[model samples]
Target: IHWHMNISNQINYVAADEKRQIIPYIHVKDMQGRVTEYFAKDSPLTPDQIAKAPRHRMDCVDCHNRPTHIYVPPDLAVDQSLLARRLDATLPFLKQQAVTALTGKYETGDEAMQGIAKTISEFYESKYPEIGKTKQLEIRNAVDELQRIYRSTTFPEMKLDWKTHPNNIGHFYFNGCFRCHDGQHVSPEGKVVRKDCDICHTVLGQQEGAVSMASISGTTFQHPVDLGDLSAVNCSDCHTGGTGP
Candidate 1:
């Protein structure tokens, strides 16, 4: 028998002083037609209550919620531009500067455009005057790209951005797969919603600078910055869709 489930929404009923909680639940039927229900380890709902509670079958929209309108985060957007050579990697601290410019506070789209221009231009001109003069074209291109990124990802009118909506594809910037597979959800039989990295996808290869590693089977997932055991927290706890933790 096979079963797949995820908690899409939760009832919000917490006092300001109380800590918020979620009680994810799942029901599965075996090949023999026997049905079993499982709730998170600390779920307060009884079997009768769980049976009566509304349930939604897993669907594409549940995972692919932002399929059409994806508000790309500044850091991810900058990394992508660098990878594509849209923003010249040879420019010193281009990624850092671009992300900094993009994440700056701005009230309107026009302000964002002006802010991006000023931030990138001022940064290069002040820090490395020679490079700023010689690499004017590259710097301009990077500024334009960063502004474009800002226009697409940020919307001050709607108060919407990458951080506003949690992308359900990966667990890096948002709680994605870790929403259920956080190891906190457990069944009565003691079966956990496995938080193992390899459970869903395999890391075929990893590359950093000039160093590259690959394997046909899979490679162990490594954190870019060592923060000790990541099992205790979600990636979204640190990565807030901006620059850094």
Candidate 2:
């Protein structure tokens, strides 16, 4: 299957009487010529008629921008390792120290790998010498795992990290859905593509466990931080992956 869009120069020709620009919709197709297309709510074609006149043809990578080569962020890697018991959380400050070690600046991938090993080994050996002595093998295994994580997720030669390539599955970290769903796309008739969040997802109760079905059904998300209202916000506007706190 393919997912593509129409981005011809003509699409950018500015129309008067609008504060925002309009762009074409995303299109999808399979090898057998079967096609599925997504359009702004304001699209002229009705639902029954859109497939015959898709705006573009698309492939796997249009949304899955990175397929094989994925760089996991240092924080996420540490969290996953701790969850999987690959890195012991009983060790004080392991998560914080691991992230710091991985994200440290280095001249090359080899240098980064060596530095990761050295930094982590030195940290445990110096600060918690008794634990280091008793759990030498476990400590060594952790160093190896962290080194592996860093080597796999980072390419200092290319200066690539999570920020360079975006995962389009969610709105956070990058402008995934907002690339088209910002509600700016409008038809000549002045109708707009709805940017309602519920169109994509409904909030199940967050941060609470063992809730009843009634609690999960109608509860809306409450942003931990007060951002006034979310109508004007896109998650990518603030969540810049590793670049952010």
Candidate 3:
């Protein structure tokens, strides 16, 4: 069980005068009855104040509302397609081009499909004419796959995509844990739900390497890019999809 917007052990509602309309404090209870809570450092309310607000237990739908209707981000789709050889990664800027084509602002789904097909075809035709001619079949396959990706992930009529319905599984590209673990939810006693990374998961050899006991026992999280201690900042602050921050 996971919980957000924890007011307190007793009170659940507090005055909404803070800058952020909703400051969520992340809470998780495991099968063994172990419960852990994280507070955002930016919370306006003090520990005493937060101790008065009400807390609601979170359900599956709170985080995974789109379980069946999952929408993949364009970048992820491109990567998967490349991995599966549907899109030729050898093409100079295949990833960049594919993402650009898929993420285009089309008024309708048909327009988007056409735009994607045209974009891929035109890019290969103009940039790599020889390879384009030789690998026309591959190019055609790529175009079909890219169009398929767009169709599965986006709904122009509903304005739905990864951005519209931010995934909550992790904190890289969307709101997710940050929606509650931002360290803003405070208690009346002035204590906040600390957003310590280790509170949720232990770092166990993150890179592509063999695992060791030392790493399993205790390993600090290493940010991909050097950002001195993300104690207060959130991932969505910089990583808004596409190329990472």
RMSD to the true structure for each prediction, in A, is 5.2, 8.8, 5.6
Candidate 3 residue spans exceeding 4 A from truth: 1-21, 24-55, 207-214, 243-245
Flag the better candidate by TM-score, 2 or 3: 3
Candidate 1: which stretches are off by over 4 Å?
Answer: 1-23, 42-52, 205-215
Report clash pairs, candidate 1. none
| Pairs with steric clashes in candidate 2 | 2-58, 2-59, 3-58, 3-59, 4-58
* Candidate 2 lDDT score at position 42: 55
The ten-residue window of minimal lDDT in model 1 covers 11-20
Q: Following a full C-alpha superposition, what root-mean-square deviation does model 3 have from the true structure?
A: 5.6
* Tens digits of lDDT, candidate 1, 2-113: 1343233221111111111243676555456555555666566666676666665555554577877888888989989889889999888887888889888888889999
What TM-score, to 2 decimals, does candidate 2 have?
0.63
Residue-level lDDT for 27 in candidate 1? 56
Whole-model Cα lDDT per candidate? 0.74, 0.64, 0.70
lDDT of 2 at 82: 88
What is the TM-score ranking, best to worst?
1, 3, 2
Q: At residue 142, give the lDDT of candidate 1.
A: 91
Judging by TM-score against the true structure, name the best candidate.
1
